[model samples]
Target: MSNNINRSLIGNILKSIRVEKNIPMKKIASALKVSESTVSQIETGKNSATKEKINEICHVCGCSFDYKTDRKKMIDLVLYIYTQYSNLSTDEMNSTIEEVKSNSFISCSYVRFEYYLILYMDGIINQNNEDVQLFKRILEIGKSSFSNKELSIYYDIKALEKMYLNDSIKA
Candidate 1:
């Protein structure tokens, strides 16, 4: 099972987020009802987490569970929603987003929606076939980058623009 547990994207992302929050290993371990040794192993990328544990950790840390969805599921969800969101005018987009945020479940839903929006936007302004291909290429790259690093908001926004605009070359 050790081979099955090595260097997971989710484990690395969790480690990066935990470091960014400046929370101690023991604290996270306690919050997740696990041992410090387990947390340490996880942070070092020796193990991955179960989805249920990921949910509990997110609740305890007050951080969004940004990486809970697998790439295929994420892509499929975004593609389906893209069909709807693309049909809306800019004004409708703004209004719908605002109204959604007013709900109690906004935080959870918004995170997923926001993730989808970036991908949707990327698919919209495809300058050519090459541009579209690069966008998908970078989606995989983006996943790996986030595995051990926190993507800044500015970076995310810039990446979104470049992806949709075909301005960036798969970074």
Candidate 2:
């Protein structure tokens, strides 16, 4: 999980989604058979929601939570989504970024390695220090677990980073 999807952001996302569906927090609390203050605490990030509670919320939203078990397929899906999102408007791109960042499908080592590869490319494209650092950190964490394909991408990102730095120096 990325640092971007912290407790507060998760709470906010849940709250916003509930509001968008015209569901009140009090109603959700009643459905969960919990006090309104408990739900309020979860929404404000003051308390953590159990897995069962999250599932209940998903049920209320008329959506099923997919705990993707297939690592390879999940990676493929993320790549496909990335390809499709490339041409999205800025707002849509931001939304997609947030969604990807929030999703925990990268729990698998291979998927996490692939995610870091994508993050590295994003850093190269944007030339941002934090993204570059994050990519490096992820690369280090997953270095031993990397497949040959990931190694290729890691090296490519390194080359791209050098080029970006050179261009910056010249500018």
Candidate 3:
């Protein structure tokens, strides 16, 4: 992959889908006619796979390979849902959240962290919960792996969450 391409982001997406679908690295490696270690390297962003190899990995994992655009759309949707929280009805908001969660292409750890952050911001998820802790851990561990936009969202939401919690405690 070129230096311009976000290797870790792509790797995380593929790895997430693979693990979620219970598809083994060996299976993807076999499909790509490569060794399991090669698949591991690709998934960990230690090595890059060609576009054709990525597509074959996706095919083996039963997902489509339109992630570049899908990822952007998913981020846009999350931002829209956050900004338009009051304009949307309860059902609409719930439906939108479910849509994001169900999208196989949007399974990157940073994206998932952003999703959970939005949910916490909207009061859809409680502040004290396993989901929040899990995503927070993801953010901390993968801080270097995330994009600038994603990190911006994380810091913004975290500040907002802290302010809101403080106000609630004072009340």
The most accurate candidate by lDDT is 3
Cα lDDT of model 3 by residue, 1-171, tens digit: 355346765566567667656788888888898899988888778887678877888788776676444445556766666555546465676777767666535443335445544554444233444366455544554455545765676666676566656754433
Q: Give the number of colliding residue pairs in candidate 1.
A: 0
* Native RMSD of candidate 2 (Å): 11.7
Query: Relative to the true structure, how large is the alpha-carbon lDDT of every model?
Result: 0.49, 0.57, 0.61
State the displacement of the C-alpha of residue 47, model 1, in Å, after optimal TM-score superposition. Answer: 2.8
RMSD from true fold, candidate 1: 9.5
| Pairs in clash, predicted candidate 1 | none
Candidate 1 segments whose C-alpha is farther than 4 A from its true place: 1-7, 66-171
**Tens digits of lDDT, candidate 1, 1-171:** 234333454555465455535667788899888899998776556766776776776666566564433444444444444444556555554454344335423223213333423443444433323344443443333344332212332245446557666677853
Ranking of all predicted structures according to TM-score, beginning with the best and ending with the worst: 3, 2, 1
Query: lDDT value for candidate 1?
Result: 0.49
What's the lDDT for residue 6 in model 3?
64
Better of 1 and 3 by TM-score: 3
The best candidate by TM-score is: 3
**What order do candidates take by lDDT, descending?**
3, 2, 1
| TM of each candidate vs. truth | 0.39, 0.41, 0.57
Model 2 segments beyond 4 Å from truth? Answer: 1-69, 77-99, 104-110, 167-171
Error of 1 at 18 (Å): 0.8
